[model samples]
Target: MVVMGSGGHTTEMLRITKHLNKERYTPRVYIVSSTDTTTISRVLAGEDSSGTYTICKIPRSREVKQSYLTSIFTTALSTVSSFPVVLWHRPQLVLCNGPGVCIPICAVVFLAKALFLIDARIVFVESLCRVKSFSLTGKILMFFADKILVQWPDLCKVSKRADYIGRL
Candidate 1:
């Protein structure tokens, strides 16, 4: 499964997936923000017509220009709604880069792991835009992610555990 935010986050995640071995990563699922129709369209247009993958839309944790109170409320609701989707899919690996949408999904995966419901390994790739430090999403997920990959070597200094795997 892949969690996509908007614009750059969605593009970067999709680009990384292109390199994945189709034989190994068959039947992939893309989790997108409900308002992000652009990504949904892009995925559908780019994917093979064989029905090997699909997209799942969920409410965004926070919308642009949204108030803090509303963001909090929406984030909570989004997280709750995502629980069942994550539980049902039970992906062996949950891959995400820096995206606000990833937080809630990763939280669901963490809870699932704690409850022994799923054994999904989270591989978080810090956004390529972050050359000096980790993004806010990356910082929060670092503690829980099974492996954190960074595109820039400088980011390796931010967290000893992070691997500088070069650009995706």
Candidate 2:
């Protein structure tokens, strides 16, 4: 499963997946926020609707300029809504970059792992735009992800576990 954020995050996610070996990563599941219609369209455009890939929508963690209280409530709702999907799919790998939507999904994956409900590996790739430091989502996911990849060599200093794998 892959989390598709908005704009740059979505673009970077798509770019990285484009190089994946189809035989190894077939029948991909893409998770997008409910308000992210543009991302849904972009993902669909690249997918082979012949049952090779699917796009799943969940509520957004928050809207632009949304109140903190509202964001918290919605995030919790999104997390709850995502539980069944994560449990049902039980993907071997959950890939994501920096996105608000990733917070809830990653939390679910972490809890699922702790409970032995699923054996999914969380791989987080920081965006190429983040040259100096980790984004909010990246920082939050650091503890949960099995591997955290950075495009910049400077970011290697940010975390001992971070890998400077060049741009994706």
Candidate 3:
């Protein structure tokens, strides 16, 4: 199962799923966020849908910016909601694209003893001369992920847990 922050990432993830060998692997997508209207409309809903995909909206207002009060409230609520979703799906493996949306859900998967794969790559290294705040999520991911994959070797350098998986 694949879980992520938003529809754009979901679209990219679906592209990755397209490469999987269907005979060996069946793909199911789960979107974890406050809402995924675009993903639900474009991918999760349709006559072609087989109900293989599901969406779980964490109970939080749609505010991208972080605040101490909102973070505590949302995190608590989302953490509470994550269990039933994990129990319902019981996926053998869970893949995550780095974001706050996946945090509580990944915790659920870990608590359920499911394997986790985290997509973590360092970006803007040359342009910005450093990894950004986005890359900090990689550190959090490394703590839980069974396998932490990085597109660049530079990212591997920062995270002791990462394996060089080639450029994404």
Task: For each candidate in the order shown, give its overall lDDT on alpha carbons.
Answer: 0.88, 0.89, 0.55
Worst 10 residues of 2 by lDDT: 44-53
For candidate 3, list the clashing residue pairs, or say none.
none
Candidate 1 residues 21-104, lDDT tens each? Answer: 866887788999998879888777667887888689899998878887888899898999899889888888999998888889
Segments of candidate 1 deviating more than 4 angstroms: none
- TM-score per candidate: 0.95, 0.95, 0.73
How good is model 3 by TM-score?
0.73
Model 2 spans > 4 angstroms off: none
lDDT of candidate 2 over 1-168, digit per residue (tens):
999999998999999888888668977999999888799888877776577887889999978788988889999999998898899888889999888898889899899999999998999999999999998788989889999999999999999889889987
lDDT of 3 at 70: 68
Winner by lDDT between candidate 3 and candidate 2: 2
